[model samples]
Target: MVQLDATTQEVLNRISEEFAQKGAYNLRQNGVALCHGDSEHIKIRKKEDKPGIDILIDGDTKGERVFIPVVVSVSGMTDLVYNDFYVADGADVTIVAGCGIHNSGCNESRHDGIHTFHVGENANVKYEEKHYGEGNGTGSRVLNPVTNIEVGRNSVFTMDTAQIKGVDSTVRETNVELAEGAKLYVLEKLMTDGEQKAESNIEVCLEGSGSSAQIVSRSVCKGHSLQTFHPKAVGRNKCHAHIQCDSIIMDQAHVGSIPEIQAEHVDAAIIHEAAIGRINDEQLLKLRTLGMTEAEAENVIIENFLS
Candidate 1:
């Protein structure tokens, strides 16, 4: 692993300390690549024409993990990066990625990331990501991430993402395509407070027979925050897909969930579920009766809901 400064380590610790300790890892700061480490099964290389990297995972690689994390602490800085991944056939591995920002001046700090992944036949890939921001500056912390994934025949792709806390603004988008006998599952969690705003849009296309997919989202909004979610599933063959969106609203917060399904074949099966509401009064009362304040009760309910 490469040496890190205090600011970099602070942001890494907030996201995941184990990421820096991983054998295969890449760290990017400001507008440059800081350091990257490669393992026996994974190789990370900087892109020739872009401000990002290309990761190649060996075939049949098991029990291996890769970490790709970026941080922006300089105020008024805007960072954009494009990263790609190639996973060989029969490989089973996990990839961790996210961005952290801290602004200490009166200028906004923003990071935008575009990632594309290719999964080979019979491969299994699990990807995890988290976004976070913090500082006492008047500047806003902004993040926008776009992901594109292609799952090969008989392959499996699983994605889990979260917005932990302190992000001022964000727009998250994802697109996925699956081939024959492929499987996909995605779970996203988010929390916002104090005038924060977030929007998420995701679409999945099942283009081959026997393909299946499921997408689920959970979010919490508080203190004048606003959130919107759009999740869609498209079935072009004899496949099945499901989308679920759920949210909790509190203290003048606003939330909207729109789910869509499209079927192009007779044997296609698709479904969607959307629910947006606030904490239950009875649950809050019960918690309050247990010697908890209203704020504490609400926090507990929100935590459990997002969890």
Candidate 2:
């Protein structure tokens, strides 16, 4: 059994607390705190040529879960890692991953993570990731993440991502490609407060017959924060694709939503929608009438909006 430092454990609780338990996760704090595999069918190990890890899920496995989380607690530290996941054919699993940073110094703390997933034929995978930052310090908190996924024939991949905490700056990008009869679904939620800035870029390609994809994003901007979202989907065969981007703005905040869809074949179907607006007065008034303060009402709306 392995143990996590108090500070690191506290931060891990913000994202995937249950996986922080020993013998249940592959966790890295500042460096490799602990790394282990779930079973013979599942393996976790370092990348001999790189600074990250590789997760291998065996074929025909059913009803399994894996967690790999990272945390950074040192001020003035910048970390970069590349992780890869390989899911074998006919397997169904859920993967939980996230990064949390706790910095308390005069220098900036930043983390950049690149993840790539290969889903084999007929495999079904659900992936979730969250980002958080907390500290009382003069330094800034920053997180940038890049994800690439290749879904094989008849496979399905679903992704959920959220970042609603004290990050000062972030740029997130996701790219996906679907094979014959494959499907890709995504739901993204974000919140930016104070002077934080966030940018999201998503692109997907439905390149095989019967392949389909859908992407949706919801974000809230408060104070002087800024956020921008770009979602694009392309259909290259007898496939379907849709993209949607929506956001809420408040108190000197700014938001931009850009959605695009393209069809390259006569049988390809694609559509897109985008909207940005402020908090609805009617919604706020209703909450306030229930004896909640204006600020409290706004908070409630923001929380539900992101959810």
Candidate 3:
């Protein structure tokens, strides 16, 4: 294993703990790939023409989860990476991916990552990714991520993505296609403070009979930040799909939620819901009665709501 600097190590720890990465692991810093684990069922290697990693999970493999962490600790740098994941037929696996940036300089730092997943028949995959940024300097922290997923017949795919704090700007896009009897579930959580801006767009297609999908997104905007969310689901067969978007807006912030559902077949069913509001005064009052400060009470409420 390769050694990391103190600052880089701290950033990695914040994203994923060391003990949680007992299986296959890959660590990347500032567009450079380093420190990858070796496993028979899981394979991780660098791309031939890009600063990225390719991960492959063998068929019928079921055991510990795979962990991959990417971090950028320098300022004035733009990093781009492309990750491709291939899961074999009848395999069951879990993947944990974390990306973080620690920029303490006057220049802006940004990361753009594109991920594509190919899930085979009867396979099940659970994927989790978190994004975070921390710095005291005047630089902007930005992240742009795009994901594409293809699920085979009778397979299941679930994804959970979260962005906690300190990111100045972000644009996230996701697309998924489901085959016969395939299922997909996606959960997204986001928080923006200061003058940050974020935009998220998701599209799912149920192309085969008995395919189903569900998408849920929650966001909090504070301190003049701006956020926009768009979720669209299309059912082309006798499938079911649902989408929900919820947001909390505070302190001169702005948030917009747009959800669209389309059913091409007579037996298809699709629904969507969206809600945007601020913290409840009744809840805040109850917390204040417990001897908690206003700020602390608000924080508690936000944490609980997001959780």
All candidates' lDDT scores?
0.91, 0.88, 0.89
Query: Could you give candidate 2's per-residue lDDT for residues 124-156 as a string of tens digits?
Result: 999999899999998999999999999999999
Per-residue lDDT for 62 in model 2? Answer: 85
Candidate 1 versus truth, CA RMSD in Å, comes to: 1.2
Per-residue CA lDDT of candidate 3, range 1-307, in tens?
4667888777777777652334687877888866778577999988999778899999958954888888888899999999999999988998888788999999999999899999999999998888899988789999999999999999999999999888899999999999999999999999999899999999999998999998989888999999999888999999999898999899999999878788899989998989999898999999999999999999999998788
Per the 3 Å backbone cut-off, how many clashing residue pairs does candidate 2 have?
A: 0
Candidate 1: segments with Cα more than 4 A from true spot:
none
Candidate 2, superposed: residue stretches over 4 Å from native: 22-24
What lDDT score goes with residue 9 in model 3? 77
- Every model's TM-score: 0.97, 0.97, 0.97
Best by lDDT: 1
Clashing pairs in 3: none
